[model samples]
Structures are given as C-alpha cells and as structure tokens.
Target: MNDWISHFTSLTAAPDNEKALFNKARPVQWGSDQIIFHAGTPCNQYLLVLEGQIRVQQISAGGREIVLYRIGPGESCILTTACLFSHRPYPAMGITETAVKAISLPKSVFDQLIGQSGLFREFVFNAYGNRLTDLLTLVEEVVFTRLDIRLARKLLDLGKHAQIIQITHQTLATELGSAREVISRALKEFALRGWIRRGSGQIEIIQRQGLQQLANSEFVSSR
Candidate 1:
C-alpha cells in the first residue's frame, strides 16, 4: 500500500481496508507549472495529492483565465471526481503550481472502489461537496461583489503575512478574473490614495488600514 496513510491523514479508512485502494493507486509526479490536464480532455485516472499544489482554472471564451480552486496536500480534485462520476471530459485545465506528487487510481479501479468501499465513497463525496461550495462562493463573489472591493480584499489577504506582495498586475487580474488594464488602473487609484506603492512586478502595502476600509466599503468601482 506504500504507506499512503502517512500523507493523507484525513482519509480515515482502517489500514487493512485502505490497503486495497493504496495498492491500486500508483504514484505520479509533475514538475512545477506543468499542465496535467487540458480542457475537454477525458480523464482516465483519479488523483489524490500527497504533496505540493495543483491549480484548477478555467479560461473564458475571450481567453481570460480565472482560478477555480487549488488542491493541496491531502486534498483531491473535485473536477476529477465530477469527470469520473459523470463520465465527461474536463471542463477546465489543471496545472501544477509546485512540483507535485500524487497517487493515481485508474478509472476502472476508481469506479470499483466507489461501489465496493464505503470509506472511499465518503472520501470522494466529501471532497466533492466542499469544492462545490467553494465554486458557489466564487460565483456569488463575482456576481454580487464589486471588483475594487474584491481587489482590496485580495491584497489584504495576500499581504496578511508580509507587507510586500510579490506579484504583477496581470497576475492579479488573472486571480480576480479581470483584465490586466483594469487591474492596473485600480492599482493606480490605490496608489494615488496612498494605500499602496507599485514597484517592478510587486506592490508594497503602505496602508493596510486604508485597504481594510475599502475592502469593507460598498461603493462599487467602475470596471
């Protein structure tokens, strides 16, 4: 079983019960920024992340990329679950944000495990539920929230542990599902208000309180 229990502590199956699953799932690895799955591709395996991060994102018809969610250690890709259950091609792309290591169960074994193992069913369904909630929350934010408020909140969240955010305007645009020009203008406004300072490929937080105030405000920025 390769002692997968050590990495995936959230999987609560008894050792003997889990052995069948772990034995069937072969280990896989990917380098950082590698595309693991392309949009519209059929999935033949289900993966459980053992280390590093995988970013699942969707690109609009206009070619704007927005992150759907990230799967980290001990987490599984809900998209993979959806694909396996519905027997459809991937609706979005998956890329490894960091060098990743995971255990991959073939589609046949995955299907069998879901039917034959109660513990496996729980693990898969629970992950699906949680990721679905995240997607819903993201949709709500995009539709109901202002872009400027969301941008301010993103800055505050990113700088929670540091004053400097090591990112670019285009990257922030991608993160917020907006355009680079739009994000650049908003950041310029923030800079004008003395809330932040834009540097080469980075932004320094000058006034966290100011950003906090804006993040809590209801005034919508014209994006």
Candidate 2:
C-alpha cells in the first residue's frame, strides 16, 4: 500500500510515524450519495479522504440546507477533527457526493498521533486553518453578495468537469442558501439571455462567455 500520507505534501514523512499510521489506519469506502455522518452524532473516527468527495452541509429543521465545504482527495474534514478533539457530536452532517475512499483512524490512535507526530500536528492545524478561511468566505458571500452573481459562479464551477450539470433548482437553492423560486428567477434571466438551457434536473451551458462575464462583474445588472 502506498503511504497514503504521501498524498498530503504538507505532512513530512517519518518512518516511525508512517508505520504507526499504516498499522492503525483502516481503509473504508462509501457509495455515492451515502450519508456518512449526521448532526448530533458522535464522531468515532477521524477521516482522511484518499479518493472522491464528501460534502459537509448543514440542514435545518424545515429541510433547508447550505453546503459548508467539500472534503476531497488529500484533504480531511475540519468538523471531524474538531469533534474528535473536543469530544463533541457533529454540528453538521457529512454526505458522500461520489464513491469515496478514505482512511479512518480510531480516536485513540488519532489522539496519540496528534501528540507525538509533529508532521501530523502541522497537517491537522493547516487543514483546519484553510477550511476555516473557506467557511469565512462562504459566510461573506451568503451575507453580502448578490444571489445572481453567486449562482452564475456556482454554475460555472459545477460545470467545469462536465458539459451538463445534473442538479435541480431546489438543490441549487440549497447550495446557495436561498429559496427555490429565487434561483429559478435568476436562472430564467440567464436562459432568456441565451446563456443556458435548463431541463429536468439538468443544466446545459449554451454560452460560457456569457456566464464568465456575469460571474466576474458585480456591477453588471440583468438589464
């Protein structure tokens, strides 16, 4: 097995630490769309994703949701780390967006490694700091940015790897923390302008430049 720790370039390799991690880290997998953790659930293991994506999100009692962040290859969850360290249940939920492969380190092993391994400690804190920054940015966007600009940007980002994005407006609203009707109205404006075409549960980009222009300028009005 490849020293999975190698995926994280920030973690300097030590033979002893690598050996210990290898012995204790259990490989795990989850199918796409699986719920990995829920709010108020105690975290039993610290996860380091080796492949695929796990989306961390917060869902409200009335079924509204806002995506917090995604944990992808070479990354770990800050929420999981916080839970492990603080002995607290998860504040939000983690669900697999795709088939996921990861290493699960038991809480006891994680505690010991965080104490003894400088590289491990550094890696943990750095990941935490980076995710914290991302969350802060998300907060800023949700608070002050216009929804149309965010929607354009989000569509561009989601369409990067695929020509057609498979998502519903309701899901997109959940992503942007807005009502479905608001997202539909924005999307209608984009469609009327010949930028995109929306179908059942799918969105196809008709003109990338149009979206690029909208996503880049905060001053550009729909008029």
Off by over 4 Å in 2: 9-12, 15-18, 161-163, 219-223
Q: Residues 1-223, candidate 2, lDDT per residue (tens digit)?
A: 5477677777646566555665788889999999999999999898999999999999888878899999999999999999998999999989999999998989998888887888788889999999999999999888877788899999999999887999999999989988899899999999999999999999999999999988897653333
**Cα lDDT tens digits for candidate 1, 77-147:** 99999999899999999999999999999999898888877777888899899999999989878877898
Clashing pairs for model 2 are none
Which one is best on TM-score?
1
